[model samples]
Target: MDPHDRYTQNNFWQSSQAANAALTGCYAVLRYSGVYGGAATPLWEETASPNAYNYSNSDGWNSIAEGLQSSTTGGIISSRWANCYEGIGRCNYFLANVDRVISIDEATRTRMKGEAYFLRALFYFLLENYWGDVPLILDPPDPSTQSNLPRTSRQQIIEQILKDLDSATLVLPLKYGSSDLGRATKGAAMALKARVLLFEASPLFNTNNDKNKWKLAADAAKAVIDISSSAGYGLYPDYRSLFLPENENNKEVIFDVQFIYPQEGNSFDLICGQYNSNAPLLDLVLSYEMKNGLPITDPSSGYRPDSPYLNRDPRLYATIVYPGEVWVSGSNKVTVTSSWFPITGYAMQKLSVYNSATKPPVKASDIKDGQSYINYIVIRYADVLLMYAEAQNEFIGPDPSVYDAVNQIRARVGMPNVAPGLTQDSMRQVIRHERRIEFAGEGLYYNDIRRWKIAELVMNSPIYTWKHTLIETRRFNPNRDYWWPIPQTQLDLNHNLVQNPGY
Candidate 1:
């Protein structure tokens, strides 16, 4: 069966339902499986490590951050950008053709169309976050239109994305049933819209503050929060379970890029973990507050860096590894670096899937099986909470609910509650820090800093200085380094496209 076939089945709305399936395939490329293959796994590492990304076939992940002159990691990034646009074209194809679902009701047709718009926007959003000034191509332009096309302004691309989100907001149901677990919903649309607005209001895009941008972001987030508390979307009881195979269709996931072992899910983990140490930095590990809301910096916390595991939040144990950390591995001990080391020395363990009791043991032969089969989260409820806090802080000046949001996350960790009477600026600092710790190693850091327009402040410092060796250390070069130069191949082929500043 050709998975790439334009159409496979007919739907009630599609004159030929096969078209909708083919169209949805456009969104599937974002998954761990699909067109880009196992190499896409490098993205998470690239975002998290540089010096540590070296080993075996892991150089690609390192090169992305180390600035290799010409590398496979660079190639993966290039191909990913191109493939994403191909997906954009597919969505354009559906938006251009969904009218064919003859028997479909007006409502279904509208919702389907809305899904397409959301997908297209998502694709562009990915591009915007990475390359900054990417060419935004809308619609399936005729051959005549292609030759004349040039890069579109980032602002223009954002405008188009907002239009799509607004369209999605009009038709999707608030929630979907079990069978429709992975499908887009009104909640997903709103969460994404709020995120986009917050990104826009962020220092990266809004640069000059522009009052209205912040207000719009606040309003968008408020709309989601208004419904989110009552909506079924929320955090899972076990933070570790969020990444486990058993939690594939959990309630906490807003939208996940579905994957199936061998078939759709290839060796994403086996390849990513080959030799590279996907280390989750120390700042990220300690950000989880003491169940009492106090930071590890609090003297009352009795947080012994030596015995960090004794009384810290459970999530710390779930998401990170400190000395003596042990996970099941066949008959071997899956040990963590000894606690003798400093925080950054601890490696990230959030994606671990090594238990043999409840699940199949990792086969030395089939590395993929050793990894979890859970779907990769494309967007989760936790992100919405962060977005809500960020937007609210920016608009409302760190209201009590800001602490409410932060504490909710801390509560799960069994830490003390955060102190009240904090300024918006101070609370925003904590949220940003907390997000770094919470979402570490999940492909968020780079974008998080960029959106905050604090890339220079964060990346400009010594980023990955391996304390033990000269083998890995890097300095962020802002002028020529912020964005990868347009792929050399694209530059050679598309004379119409221009490179970003200082590239």
Candidate 2:
């Protein structure tokens, strides 16, 4: 018998250890490049929106941003589709066989099954968001029967996703021991459910202006907020420290994809800092409010065009490395002509651990590829608060609860409370703008613009550098660009698969 092939398919699921290993395999898929794996994959997603620009076409996001994406748009379009289904297949196999492990305790088995359900739902959620309709394969793959499966409606897939989350919430623990810190938890399931409901209720999906859908979304988000204390979830006090590796699994983080150096690492610092692959656009930089919580365009806001970076939102300084900004150390300033960043004249500062404050400061030469191990936060308490505010405001104007939720986020960063007694339409813009500033460089803006159906307006404009130099003019087709084309390779494999319109 071959020592490497110690167990065959028939014997693999017979023990508790084997069952755990199988479940772990399901989680491993999240680390794939197509999924939320490396720093580049998630951060590069901003390139698809107006928040950032990718200088190179190698990642496929530059092409998509330029309105040049097609069935052959190979990088993210193909990988995301393939990796998500690959995750689904692994989860399906684990769920199908884990029950065979009689050595496991009933409670442990239940929790393990809950994890499998959550992973499957997450993978499906990615598919629903990007592809709209996809092959809903819940069982272990059988080439004979599953090879030619047709697309399932997104509504049906969402129903199944919610069902799985409900099941997960019942069995997953509110908190795990330190040894299992990064595993899925009950709070994570509820938080993900809130996000799913909010997206479903958005204008992109609920086209009839359905108030009831917004209420469902508001209630779902409120449910998570209600359990925040018991679940040990809240805003991490310092905005800049929140992304540091030392702050991983902080109270603010509801769910995050964990990474560790040597064993498992990412190229976040190298690609985002040195290469400037995902450069913050001038449009995003200008969206930040002044220190007094007023728009820069406001006459009384104290935002000077010449000294643009001074007296800006604190989060702006925390998130972006602009020209003349102190970078690695207090004395090390980023000059305008620095070759380290030449794309958009701005580089991402968040999610990198190379600052002067460290015991041994990390220099530019010290940064290496696939060595940064910062955990990528997927959902957090701040997002829940934002979702609740947005959904509730849409459902019943700007209620007191809406004010409280929005104000809490602002208070954490030392900004003033949202202006009192604003009309519903005005408050809507406030919540949207707050999200743009709050979640900048975190890869959420692209979906926000799409769900709000404002992509055509924002993405069709010209992207510029900090000096107001035109970088490129982007395009967004209202009819087809809203949904990416199914990969042409997938179409070749499955004749039943149809391409999205305008491809």
Candidate 3:
């Protein structure tokens, strides 16, 4: 609630609507323009990955991608740190004050508090991903006491996150009413915990390659799958249309940053602009396999460089605009190049509502208005399935459950299932590839490559566009690039702050 609004009603928290609004305010943090909201968001972190690149060096992600990120680097690093902590602060404030509201029913109060907890854990998770260790503040900070709080280890933070999610599951409802569609749920908490555990068990954190850790991660994911029906969670049928605004609250979505153009003054179209920013890179285009479930590089796959877009994975058409692809802008049917020229020769088609068959799709005008309502999905059922496949494959070689999970994802997009009797190592490769294509432009690529320890191999070479146009000779200093430096401004604010090594 705004301070002016609070001033008008001295006892705002005593009213149910006002109290609910405070809880809603905690959620408002997720819509921060720099994180999940506007053009450059957490997804912009993808630019640091080999999956995509920004043509402009001034682009925020380019600094981190090119190994120039420093304590003073004020793009994604500082924005995320500031915004995420802002979100955590909001959650803290809500939790500290919500108890004083007597008008809210006990059930609603518990659920609202649970949502605040989940949102807090999520903000911390984002912090840990970029900057390895961060100061863990549960309650609203007391300037008197927290003026010089030190950083907490990532492992301890993860433990606290799991505790929050566990507590959340005990009170959060299985689903929310339509009026409260985008609020967090029990399934979302579980799914997020599964993701954290999987990341915690990965090579980066689990340097010992402990099988027990993988089993723990697999079990956590399986817990989410086990509650699918009760939680109203399943795969949405149309892979291409899943991100559309009309399908915002589908069963596949566990948690999403809700956005509505004009109403919220936020646009997904503007987030991934025409060709100026966040364009699909050539390396990503080549990663998609053929329709027949064979890689383009395989001799028997029937891939021809001269006509590369033909007979490729169905997802490729749904994801990128190849040279000859038809693109609809307003009522005009024109090739993609006429409207947008991708620096990498491949324009982004994911999350964009355009088609040659229909002159004005329901969302056509939103793009032109810089107003799109597509909710940015954070955790979806597909991710759970893929995480389960990865964890289970690591825990025990290929098994029936592993195939069952992987096959469900393939069936949704009309792709053939993995052949039976594959070794654990082979299945690992398959699961990794499946995740790459299934979530191409969704911001998970950076997390995957980092956890799998493959960023250095892929990012150290010169990158070219589809037309062999050289874009950049990327650099990755493995010694210091894995973790971003603590912001210089932050260090100056708190003398207790410690910078990451090599900063």
Order by lDDT, highest first: 2, 3, 1
Can you write out model 3's per-residue Cα lDDT over 37-74, one digit (the tens) per residue? Answer: 66445446667777777767433688888888888877
Lowest-lDDT window of 10 residues in candidate 1?
A: 48-57
Quote the lDDT for 339 in model 2.
50
lDDT of each: 0.65, 0.87, 0.81
Regarding TM-score, does 2 or 3 come out ahead? 2
Q: Which candidate has the top score in TM-score?
A: 2
**Candidate 2 error regions (>4 Å):** 1-4, 32-34, 328-339, 356-364
Ranking by TM-score: 2, 3, 1
lDDT of 1 by residue, 108-136 (tens): 77888888888888888878766777877
Q: Which candidate is the best by lDDT?
A: 2
Cα lDDT for residue 87, candidate 1: 76
lDDT, candidate 2, 1-503, per-residue tens:
43555887777877888998988888888773548766336888888889899897646989989889998878888888888998899999988888888999999999999998999999999898988999899999788888888899988999999999999999999999899978999999999999999998899988999999999999999999999989999999998899999889999999998888887788778757777888999999999999899899999999898899898888897788787765444555444343547888888877777442432235578877778889889998999999999999999999999999999988988999999989999999999998998888888999999999999999999999988999988888999888889999999889998777788
